[model samples]
Target: MRPALRTRRACRKLATALMASTVMLAGCASAQPAGTQAPASVSARPSPEATGPVAAVYKDLVYRSIDGTDLHLDLYTSAHANGQPSPVLVYFHGGAWARGQRPESWRGYSRFLQRGYAVITVQYRLAGEAQAPAAVQDARCVLHWIGANADRYGFDVDRIVAHGTSAGGHLALMASYLEAADGLDTPDCEGVPRVAAVLDFYGPTNLAQPYNGAASGRHPSVVRWVGDGPGAHDMDVRMSPLTYVGPDVPPTMIVHGDSDDVVTIDQSRELYAALQRVEVPTDMVIVPGGGHGKFPDAEKARVAGEVDRFLTTIGLP
Candidate 1:
């Protein structure tokens, strides 16, 4: 993983240097499940250097997973608030579960860090390295460890949100919809931790469907994660968030690109509808022609605005 640097600029030249390879999204819609729009004055595209009264300080740590991989985390705590740790945001980056790393792929989330919030940019074992449930298990362990070590970091006990993009989005939603552990017998499965909320960005809700072409071409990563492909995927129902539904879930916010070819709009749409059907507080924002995270300026701003509203509505302070 690459090192994370503090950004004082609004738009970054680093992200622009490499164009991600993926199909582009055409149009996406906004479906807010809660919260009113922000006042007209807030600049949607503010720089990382641009923040309110809150001042941010960045830090790092390693949380061990079930497989013993030294999962890395980039934590940002507010400098303006009391010297304490404050609310922590556990964030996972999107790269189809096989690509991406903390701080290397995402720069916009520093906004959360600036708000007197401790933001965690973490890395888990990829699909190829370990099969399904391993990543989820690792994520669960990190959350519990973060909560367990709250005193060490001065972390606020009540505010720990699971946030992610693309594949990361799927993982975040899973944190809410699925059990913290794989099953009843897994080690350290005792006294598992749950998230306060879920923030999903263009994530695929159901991986049972093949991607790119057939199951082997585009969905090999998912197949590897599940330890099965196509017909065999459903047997790993324990890994799917959709399989576990009952009302004990935290609020959820979903953002997707309507034209996204990588994860498909139906993925987010299906999740939003399912969450609403079950009366789980949820929001869905679909950007027009926004394919993947490399969206145009206007669309990206809108997505960020939607996220801001979601977090504030849930009382993330």
Candidate 2:
């Protein structure tokens, strides 16, 4: 059954906490303060891409957050749910978490389904509706729902790979890193998703950075997610994969367009450095001349192959 979906309300608390982070972003050579930040807006909506043959195979499902906030997702599996377990790839869409949908990111997303991996594209609350952890929480809920339904969906829970592009990448990384952080025995509200690998595509890893600056055109989205003040550093660190680096993290892959204009390639660099620092099995793929949403075929294939290799290495494929 499709879960009833709800756009989350933007809470004053989350907005207030982001004030300091917002200020920090403004000081960047290219960043602006929130007041000076451009008003929230979206690019012209992308034309719908054809879903291809595999889209015909998967089922559509929805799940609610722990708080019962509605979230939607699409699941693409093999011909039969009872077939032997296969590696699973879950994706979150970009749009800065403000105005994108899972289906709109489909040309590349569909390509994954044809690779013999079960794929899921999800829709979480956007910044316009809520903010930071709200989107993260929604993504995590979808993963948890996947784990619970794996038996019926024909995938191994431990063989999953969590991945996302841009803002979605941040959420994906946060979702998995939260699991790693849970090892600290922190509060239960800290959400986590168990996955064998992470694919962060030019994701923002530092919330306190200038990329989220008001002048950067991403300030509103960042502010919506984390809030408007410095105290939100706890949430920032909590969301940052850099904060929980350890050997326990699944083998990881970082793919970024070196020329990405929306989220800087440096974010991927930071994540790569942190992963290397901890001796986590990691691979970094830099696609030259690719800008935001402009990945070439070869680069896209490389991402698929890397995830494929990660799954194969762990006996997940």
Candidate 3:
């Protein structure tokens, strides 16, 4: 049976309490302050060529500009739109928060397009250029941008879903879970509606813990993104998606590989437990021998089927 959803007011109250404890949990360490950033000046225009199953493609649409840097996202509208608003999947790429670009291959997402969902793949600041919360801020900004321009793009604002893999999965969870009260949203992009759902694939839920716990020591990529300082550990706690788990968060589905070494299956387990405690509708799919994202072809097919069923169950279909 589906769990009873909590009222928004109740969820916010719980979220407020969770956020309030940051000071006590990480003594003397505060979250990184939001930077002064502006909306992107570039307007999105359609590409000259339309591709298979995609009605139109808009590339390099600037979403946010921070300190002279312009962040971009690619928009692909489905050929099946047929003059109706399309459900959206806002995707973030995973690179351990340090590397990785917006997706170049459309094979994985082509099904969504064929099924009439518009897909937006975003690009954000990496750890090489910024630290904790910067990427999170960028992720939130992309949602705001989508919300602000939904009519212009024929997007269904109410059905926007956050989907990402690895580090990107972490961003998707952060973008979907954190509210304006958390002070993580960019000033210019505040008040965007919350995501309808979240799809997290092997994303790290706890930044405070070592990579895969004691089994793998510390991960350099996580250390780089969280930074090194007196407040570093505090920032780790602040950056963790696990920190923001509350009843108000969107319905979520997590997929992880039990045999993965890069990001342990325990991460997803903890998130599932937290969500269940809060009575949020959530699901977890663990592949028996999946490694990171390198699932065998059969396993990949099974996971894809599971994802499709989950999405349909959540009204995305």
lDDT tens digits, residues 184-226, model 2? 2112223334777888878887765554347643346566666
The residue-by-residue lDDT of candidate 3 on 251-305, one tens digit each, is 9999999999998898899899989999988999999889999888988898889
Per-residue error (Å), model 1, residue 201 = 0.2
Scored against the true structure, residue 70 in model 3 reaches a CA lDDT of: 76
Q: Which stretches of candidate 2 lie over 4 Å from their true place?
A: 1-60, 65-69, 80-82, 104-111, 180-193, 211-220
Please list the Cα RMSD from the true structure of every candidate, rounded to 1 decimal place: 15.0, 11.4, 5.1
Judging by lDDT against the true structure, name the best candidate.
Answer: 3
- Best model number under TM-score: 3
Clash count (model 3, backbone only) = 0
Name the runs in model 1 displaced over 4 angstroms.
1-60, 65-68, 83-85, 104-107, 180-186, 210-212, 215-218, 229-231
> Using Cα atoms with residue i matched to residue i, what is each candidate's TM-score against the true structure?
0.74, 0.72, 0.86
Error of 3 at 192 (Å): 1.9
Candidate 2 or 3, higher TM-score?
A: 3
